[model samples]
Target: MESETYHGYNIWGHAIQQHEEPHRPGPYAASGTITQNNRVIEASGVLGFFDTDEGAQQAGLEWARAWIDSHG
Candidate 1:
């Protein structure tokens, strides 16, 4: 999980490793959440999947930032 503050809102990015098959590594699922004053403003289910954890997390963060930009 990674977090950042944007436009006075807290944005959280999450990367969840998935195991779709045995003896094979699966993709990482990306998700994001936006909060203000400790309350959830918006959240995403699975944005997409990526090969690396950092990639997934970065995707999530970018999604959250975009959401904020469009909404604000």
Candidate 2:
């Protein structure tokens, strides 16, 4: 993925292509990133992308909910 700036945050998403269908890897997979003063942070598994960010978050949240339901 190319370096990109999002919302004045100077962030870039390091999106990796999956070798399967939907042509995308579940919104959050390998890694996602943001930079500040040359320091990079892991936004991976956080669903921070413009397109699938919501879906990614929903996916994770659903997993969490299911865990609670199963346990409690």
Candidate 3:
């Protein structure tokens, strides 16, 4: 999980590990959440999957930033 503040709102990026087969790690799921004053503003379901956890997290962050930009 990673977090940052954007436009006075708190944004979070998460990477959820997945399993594709027995004893094998699958891609990471990207998700994000946005909050203001500790109150939930928006939360996204899985945005997509990526090969690396960092990639997924960055995708989530990018999605969150775009959301904020469009919504503002």
lDDT of 3 by residue, 10-68 (tens): 99999999978555444788999999998989999999877899988888888899999
lDDT of 2 by residue, 1-72 (tens): 434444333344344433455755454443345555676533446443324544444444443334334544
- Look at candidate 1 and tell me the lDDT of residue 43: 94
What RMSD does model 3 have?
Answer: 2.7
lDDT (0-100) at residue 37 of candidate 1? 99
Q: Select the stronger candidate by lDDT from 1 and 2.
A: 1
Q: lDDT at 54 for candidate 2? A: 43
- Local distance difference test, candidate 1: 0.88
Please say which candidate is ahead in lDDT: 1 or 3: 1
> Candidate 1 lDDT, tens digit per residue, 1-72?
999999899998999998876654447989999999989999999988778888888888899999999998
- Scored against the true structure, residue 22 in model 1 reaches a CA lDDT of 60
Candidate lDDT scores, in order, read 0.88, 0.43, 0.88
- TM-score, candidate number 3: 0.88
Model 2 pairs in collision:
none
lDDT of 2 at 10: 38
